[model samples]
Target: MQLQKLLSLIRQAVDRYNMIAEGDKIAVGVSGGKDSLTLLYALKKLSQFYPKHFTVCAICVDLGYDNTDFTGIDEFCRNLDVPLTLISTQIGKIVMEERKESNPCSLCAKLRKGALVDEAVRLGCTRIAYAHHKDDFVETMLMSMIFQGKFYAFPPVTLFEDKNLRVIRPLMLVEESQVKGFVKRQEFPVLKSPCPIDGTTKRAYAKELVAQLQREHPGTKERLFHAITEGKIEDWALPGV
Candidate 1:
């Protein structure tokens, strides 16, 4: 999980998907979590000699929670020489308090991403990088299958044609475990999530189930990831045929 290994995996995903272009500006959606922070660091390092000559900045959508500090994240970006734009919204109040959603994750995510995409557009960014690693991919596929009766997971690259923006997942090849180890090794500051049901969501259940399956049947996680990449699922294939 050192910087070298992290960059190697990131470069692999970026190359495989044709994610970056010359002089492209990418806005990294910084959630101030370990995964996002790791992505910020990895992309900053990669930009140093990526051969594509793309620039990176960070955009954080603050959910308007009280006593939630972003000073550490501000300093982290400053040290990395990356500009950070924070979009503040009352999403927390609207979704959790006013709406009182029984299932709030869906609406909350929609609002947050909408806010993030708007800011990226305002900043003239050509693409946005989300910190969705391998575990998230697997867990989301499981969720889609169990909840929606479909074998679906988001692709590594998605284009918002109307907005003229592309969403890329450079960390798609990295695992959650490697992200944790990278954060620990680098002593990066990780902010605690302000969500009331942070670890009690359906995604958490899938993560736990995946872990249990891995414990009972080794290589289960790897096989699942491989299947998603090679299973001919729509939008899951590489860039070219």
Candidate 2:
């Protein structure tokens, strides 16, 4: 069932964004989290029957936090027979000791993303794929609107100039709940975020708001997802028109 859902999502993202091509080397960012691990597994399964010729490699960046063991992740990757690369940085210590800000999510995310992209480029990967799902995209949209006063969310595909890498989100059609359920069913090894400021963040608040909306409206998530994919807002006129 997970494989079927993942195949459908892959087809949707590929058709929508033209993300993959024949003979594309893709690197998947695996943080030992449910989302990323699921992405890696799905890609591994898809590669077997994918019409186009493509390759996938798993890369993990260690933020150097105390009591965080990557042994389980290493073993899992070895068992899967996928090549795994580990990059280590002292991001967690730096954020806890030097950063005076209360919320460290943005900074940590930037650092980790940069490191992942660099690794992808260094490993000669033309495309880098992340595990951002439908809920993440919606939460980002809401966060940008409420906090940044902007009407933008993370695109399904983006090209980075510095790294010259094409970044894609294949799980854009899958919901977070589905991802969590799949992870639980598969018993994927999950890594905890070692940042001192994990729970107290603006994104957390936005996520709560989305959850409340989901509870209030049964099919709101599906409708919102449709609006995104179908370009429902393109018909609306801008202010001062």
Candidate 3:
């Protein structure tokens, strides 16, 4: 079932980004969302059949929510034999108390990402895997072009300045709908975000725009993904030949 899709994604990421090696310890950042949870489950399933000598551990950053309980995540990881590390941080408090701003996603994301990177390095992980799939990349591309006037999006793989950790997106080839379908089929446990501004955010607007475009133009998503993978940026530098 999903094993095939999971394997295909892993293989595509490996071929595209050279993500895995003979022996690598990869740390997956899980936020208990559909994307991160699906990624962790897929990676755990793929680990059994993958020939690479690598391992995966799930890391969750609890952003200081009093009512947020991680029991579901803990049970899921335990059943899958995957170790889960939950780090408690005062991100929510900081965002709500200190930041006198309407939008909190930017600040909260930056702090959480910094914490994740530091934790990955401290855990001796060579690679940090995220669950940014095709839809996320597409939304980012659209956002950059429309707002920032730049034709840039998140890359599949990037190396940090320290040269000790490599950031990789294994689900870059997977679609958001596919991941949701997989989750529904598997009946995976999902925890709703406890953030104060979860759905009413700018990213949600970008998501809605893309969804509308996708509805109007069938196969638009696939075409955009192909453009990303097949287009040649270097050709822009050359003169008309």
Best by TM-score: 1
lDDT of candidate 3 over 59-174, digit per residue (tens): 99999988998999999999988898898999999998877567687788889988988998888888888999989988877777787887767767767758478777889888
What are the TM-scores, per candidate, against the unseen true structure? 0.98, 0.91, 0.91
**What is the lDDT of every predicted structure here?**
0.93, 0.80, 0.81
Give the per-residue Cα lDDT of candidate 3 at 92: 90
Q: For model 1, state the Cα shift of residue 67 in Å.
A: 0.6
Query: What does the lDDT read for residue 71 in candidate 1?
Result: 99
Candidate 3, position 240, lDDT = 12
Native-to-model Cα distance after best TM-score fit, residue 136 in candidate 1, in Å: 0.3
Weakest lDDT window of 10 consecutive positions for candidate 2: 232-241
Question: 1 or 3, which is superior by TM-score?
Answer: 1
lDDT of 2 by residue, 91-174 (tens): 887666778546577778888888998889989998888999999888887888898887667677777767768888889988
User: Considering only N, C-alpha and C atoms within 3 Å, which residue pairs clash in candidate 1?
Assistant: none
Candidates, ranked, lDDT: 1, 3, 2
lDDT of 1 at 80: 98
